[model samples]
Target: MAEPRLGQMNASFGEGSVVLRWWEWGPADGLPVVCVHGLTRNGRDFDVLARDLAARGRRVLCVDVPGRGVSGWLPRPELYAVPVYAQCLAPLVAALGRHDWVGTSMGGLIGMAMAALPHATMRRFVVNDIGPFVPAAAIGRIQAYMAGAPTEFADAAALEAYLRRVHAPFGALSDAEWAHLARHSARVAPDGRTVLHYDPAIGGPMMAGDPADIELWPLWEAASARPTLVLRGEASDLLLPETAVRMAARVRVETIPGCGHAPALMEASQVALVADFLS
Candidate 1:
């Protein structure tokens, strides 16, 4: 299939004037859908899924949350919290008028907060591989990896290999998919080393906070009033089976088998599921 038309825009926030970058796909007048990526990940992670939705006549906006992707890094890394992300995204949400939201991991948390806003513009919500209650063990696992991640790699192949190992829990992505991920996930440093694209200091706030299980049940409850779908990886350590069961009471829950932590949602089946729900 032909590649979808892609466009980029920037929105500035805060006194220091941080710029948040986002990519747009499909027709300008098509039904809108906003997508947000997880921590340590940028907006490009939604390329496959966003393209599919765009082809189906939906306008897709994939945001590179502050400190990630090509977006400008914050002057103070301590502001890298979900509340800050949600606040920064408020203008974009308002400008969209009304739209559907697809959030992965940390993005899901931001979606919950946004959906709870008094004037929230989000109509339907799709949270990928996360829940209202994130276990401390899962948080620790992510923190450990982020803390020890290599700053530089020998080359593109080395970076791809590193991504394949660390993100193995993203499930069985094909060779091309992995290559696409690595291509957008890193950039060439002045020294010619392949470095991860995001600001490493993005982890400062997370590490500084207490290592307790993140509890946002209140936000989830408020957001649950809207049409919502929660996708969980069958072997996911973050959104446990019990949590999924509880979430099923308020919103639809679907388990993506053969993965842990999260489902990449690049597969036809996964994309179709999300598209169908939004339709």
Candidate 2:
């Protein structure tokens, strides 16, 4: 099969004066499929899936959330919460016209909020490895990781090692895949040290928030106007099986066996499921 067309990287200002970056692919006027990444992740996380969808003639857009990837860092770290994230996304979704959304983790939460709005423009929604109720244990794990995340690496090898250790939940990615991830995840500083792409302070708000007090069941329930699909990793601690079952009551649910916190849609079968559902 021919590879999908990759569009030039584009930038636009978002909430809090942050500049958001995104890449477009496939047809210029095809149905839009906005792909959002997880907390601490960038738009490049969706490259594999985006290319797959684009090859099928969908206009796929993968964006970097504020304070992450190539997007501008927030002036105040307190603005890193979901409400702000959702607000930042609203304009982007509006600009794209009616579309589909595929979000992972924090991105899923933002999508849920947007889809629940009284005048949502989403035609279909997919939540990947996240739900209304996020387990405290998962939150704790994420908090610990973000708190102590490495800022500098001596070389590419070191960065790869760190990513493999921290992102193992993404499951058995190949060395080439890891290289692709590392390419977008790190940037060399003026002093020649390689650092992760996102602002380290982005974790400030997350560390201060009590996970138990963060509830979004109302948003999830209100977003039921459109057909939804929930993708869960069978062993995900973030999206509990029970919670997935509850969400399944109103939407389609697909569990990827042998996976952990998230299913990286790098595999053909996984991409096929997402493409088919969006179509």
Candidate 3:
């Protein structure tokens, strides 16, 4: 199917001085579905899923959370916590007028917080590969990659190489898919070197201990007012299959085999599963 009908708009947070970017697509008034990306990943991570959902008649709201994608780097990366992001997203959702949410990794955590707030707007919640209490081993693995990634590259080819090495979850992409990812991940710097699109500090908060043994259940439990969908990668170390199954609250759960951390949700079967769940 074709990509979704798309457009961009600036979403303001912390006054007019700091404006983040937001993207909207599909029917302007269709049921809204907010698709959030992972920590290191930007909103484009949801492109495949967004287009699919829109094609099936849903408006998709994908965003560049502070330091990623076309969005600008934060003046202070420490402000990279979910609380800051949720504050920014509240207005964006209000502007949307209506919607549901589908978050992946970091995005999932943010959605959980939104669902838990006193008067949340989340019509439905779909968390892809994350839980209230992530495994320490998984956090370690993600930090290792996020700690120091190449910001400069000789060409898009080199950038694609990094994505393949680091984001193996996409696993054996076609040439075009590789190119698509590279184009979204890098910028042709003024000096001609390719640079990553997000702030390096994006890994900051994730590395900080949240001061709790398990911090997700309260938020997940708050989602009781809305139906929830949790997707897990069967072989994912970041989100252990057993833990994901256990997080299965008063909601639905599914797992994709042969994938880790995330399922691309690009294939027809995966799309069918998500679409059916949302419906």
Candidate 4:
């Protein structure tokens, strides 16, 4: 069978007029499902899951959040906050009429904020490997890595190796999957060196924040009132077992085994879990 036709579009948001680029799949008239990627990752992270959903007759829209992928970087790095992303995405969600949301990490936080809105058009939500409460340790870990990240790599092999080390928490991805990730996660610099696709300046606002736990319980409480599913990596340092237990009281929580911080959702089982939920 032929692969689903992939298309792209751009939307300008915020006073800075940052351009947000997104990928689309499946028939235009199909049920809409929006997939948002994690911090430092682009919409291409959802290619596997999106293709499956598209084949199932669902319209899948995967976003390249500002500063990542083909999306334009923020005029000010401070605009990298979740609230800013939520604000930028609100119009797109509203335009979809009614839709389902699937977000990973920072994307999940953005979804929470959007879902909490007074008249949110989101029908169902799937939050992947992140919660309202983010521990300071996790924040520190991310900051340390970002601070130490190499600006460029000698070749694709070097970049892929780096990605494997940092994103090993994304569960057991196959060789081809890792290659796919590397291909989308990086670009060739003018100097002919491979570099990460996201803007390095994004780390400025991220590190400027206090080195304390991030609390977004209010957003969680409001968003959880709607139908929500939380996917937690069994060994995630970010989403502790206790936290997932607490979240279970308000929404369904599924623990994906063998992963640390997040599940890639590229596996057949992982894709099925999400597809079944949205259905």
The prediction achieving the highest lDDT against the true structure is 1
Off by over 4 Å in 1: 1-14
lDDT by residue for model 4 over 196-245, one digit each (tens)? 99988876567886668888888899998879999999989888888899
Sorted by TM-score (best first), the order is 1, 4, 2, 3
Ten consecutive residues with minimal summed lDDT in candidate 2? 4-13
Pairing residues by index, what is the TM-score of model 4? 0.95
State the local distance difference test value for candidate 1.
0.88
Residue 19 of model 3: what lDDT?
56
How big is the positional error of residue 193 in model 4, measured in Å on the Cα after superposition?
Answer: 2.6
Q: Candidate 1's error at 97, in angstroms?
A: 0.6
lDDT of 3 at 65: 86
What is the model-wide C-alpha lDDT for candidate 2? 0.83
User: In model 2, which regions exceed 4 Å deviation?
Assistant: 1-15, 209-213
All candidates: CA RMSD (Å): 1.5, 2.4, 2.5, 1.6
The whole-model C-alpha lDDT of candidate 3 against the native structure comes to 0.76
